[model samples]
Target: MNLEELLKSIIHQENELYNLYKLGETFATYELPSMVEHFKWLAGEELRHKRTIESFLEEDTLKGTAVIDYLDSLSLEPYFKDERAEPADLEDLILEALIREKHSYELYDRLSQILSGSLSDIFKMMRQEELKHAYRLKILYEMIGE
Candidate 1:
């Protein structure tokens, strides 16, 4: 995909993640207090990431950088997964969130491998954030299991 397309896709995926976090937050309300807090934190982080990516896109566009549609092929599998667990299954909710974070990390990591310079740096940063999310979610998941 072209640079602009890729960026748009990334932003969309990030927003989808934020929405998923919101869904998790709603479910958390009836579960553990800690779960509610964690979901909110994750949702906020996702929203922040989405805004960051959008800012980067705007900057790059204004700079007349490589945000064109020149990719030989443009195909990105959807990254957002539905949270299928019921409200009572708080652990399942956490597991689903963890899975989303891991998927996002992998997606950004893959993009970074194909890109260079600023794009690469942005993807790497996003990948790192996803990793952080996954780590926190993993810890929360473990605590809930305990």
Candidate 2:
């Protein structure tokens, strides 16, 4: 779990989140009109995050193997729990998305604490975005009377 490995894992997790939000968008398109744009925006944000993480791989600063232990100890399972095959309940989806956003925020916050310089800055920004997503999800939940 070198820097490249860590970054690839982050990119993969971001892709999973992107898929989750895209599913949310699809479900919202048919069931919750007011939430359609919000889901789309979230999916777009995840894509952007993925691209940013991918960009790190091309940089020469990814030569460290010291972070391997931390990467190995990190659990991305919470962020990967998107039950795509489940029934399309808007409320349930939003709740799950909220949970995922919270987990993402926690992960990014921890990473920002452990890493310094550009990596720290990126994780901090990502953590903020996840917080925004959680806040918006809460508002959406209330708007839908859930």
lDDT of predicted model 2: 0.77
Error of 2 at 14 (Å): 1.3
* Most accurate candidate by TM-score: 2
Predicted candidate 2 versus true structure: per-residue lDDT over 1-146, tens digit per residue: 46676677677778877887888888888887878899899999989988987877777444563344477666756654444434358787778778778878987887777778887888899999999989988998897885
- Expressed as tens digits, the lDDT of each residue in 1-146 for candidate 1 is 55666667778777877877787777667666667788888899999988887987888742344333323432345453333434346676667667777778877787677667877788799899899999988887777656
TM-score against truth, every candidate: 0.73, 0.82
Best by lDDT: 2
Clashes of 2: 0
How displaced is residue 89 in candidate 1, in Å? 4.2
